[model samples]
Target: MPFTIKCPLDNLYGMHVFSRLPLHEAKVRYLVEEKVPSMHAMIELRSGEKVRIHFVHPAPPSPTENDESTERDAELVIVARSVADSDEPVIVTGDLNDVAWSPTTRLFRKISGLLDPRVGRGFYSTFHADYRLLRWPLDHLFHSHHFTLTSITRLPSIGSDHFPLLTRVVFAPSQGQDQEPLRPDGDDRSWAQDIAQSKNANKQDVP
Candidate 1:
C-alpha cells in the first residue's frame, strides 16, 4: 500500500503556494542555489480581516568570504520592504536560523514594523535539542501591530532539531493605533537597501 500527504485546509479552500525557488519536482530538487525559499499566503478571517503570512527558511551563515551582508539578511530585507509596502496585517514565522537579538533580526523589525511577542518576555530557545546549554532561539513568530498576543508556548519536541512555537494572537485593529510601530531611520533604510542589492545577494526568480 502507498500513501500520500495532503493539507486538508489548503485542499478544501484552494490555497496557493508561492515561492522563489521551484518545487522539489522541478529542476532543482533542493535549494542549492544562492536564494532560499519563501512561502507566503493571504488569508481572510471570518471577520473579513485580511492578513498576510510569510514563511521562510533562510540560508545559515557560511564560512565563504562574502560582504557584510548575508543571503538570510538580504531575504529579510525583501520581506521587510514587502511588509512596509502593504497595508494589510502581516505575520512572518519560520526557522530564521538566527537569534532573536541579533543585528539582522533587529534590523528586520525596524524595516518591517512587525513586533516580536518575546519583547519583555524571556528568551524561549528553540534549537539544539540534543544539548542543554547549546540551545538558542532560532524559530520565531513576528506579527504586525494589529494583533496582540493572547498566549504563547514552546511546545514539546517531536524528535527535531528545533522545538515548535505555538502562539495565539487576537486581532484588534484598534490596538494597532496605540502600538507604536518600529520605523527605520535613514541610515537603517540605506543599510537594508545595501543588503538587498549586495553583490552576493540571492537572485532567485520569485513570483
Candidate 2:
C-alpha cells in the first residue's frame, strides 16, 4: 500500500519535505487521526500479525513564543510511545522536524529501540532547496527489530523544498520460541526526572 506523509503546516515556500512509501497489500492497517502534523497507526499482515506505524511531528516550535527544547521533548514522547512497547515490526516515517544528525534524534532512536536505515547509507539532505549550505535531512523512515531493510532512496525534489525518502522493508520470520516481552522505560525515574527538569528549566527562562 502506498502512503504519503506531509507536514500540514509546511508551505511550498518553506523548506519542508514529504515522505512516501509503498507497502504490500497484504499488510493490514487502521488509519489513525493525525495526532501531530504527523500521524500513527497499526499495521498487520495477512497472517493476523500486527505492527505499528508512527509519524513524528509537533506544532512547530515558535522561537518567539516557546522553548525549542521543551517542544522537542514533548514531540519525543509521542514518538517514543509509537514503538516503546511493541513486539511487532514498526515503520516510523514522516518529516521529523529535526535533522538526522541531531542529538535529539539519536537519543530518540536509542530510547525507542528503533533503527535508522539511513545510518551508514551516506548523508542525504532533504531540506532547503533555496540554500545549498542550509540543507539537512528532515524526513526519515525508521524501522524496528522485526524488519530488515531492503533498500532506501531519496526521490527527486517534489513541490516542497525537501526531497522525499522511500524505504523498502521486509518482515523477518519469527523463531516461534517464547521470547522476552517488550517493555518501556517506565521505571526509569532518573531519565524521566531529568527530562522534566530540563523542560521546566527551559520554560522558566522563556519569560
How much does each candidate deviate from the true structure in C-alpha RMSD? Answer: 7.5, 7.9
- lDDT, candidate 2, at 7: 36
Report every candidate's CA lDDT. Answer: 0.70, 0.56
lDDT string, candidate 1, 14-123, tens digits:
22243432222212111222334456655566576667777666667756523343767887777777777777788888888789999899998998899998888878
Q: For model 2, how does the per-residue alpha-carbon lDDT over 1-207 read when each residue is reduced to its tens digit?
A: 244433343432122232333323232111211233444445556566766675554434566434555655545643554355566677776676678777667666766677787787877787876677998888777777677768888788777677767788777745322222233354543453366456442211110
Candidate 2 TM-score, C-alpha based:
0.66
- Per-candidate TM-scores read 0.78, 0.66
Quickly count the clashes in candidate 1. 0
Candidate 1 residue spans exceeding 4 A from truth: 1-35, 63-69, 199-207
Could you give me the TM-score of model 1 versus the true structure?
0.78
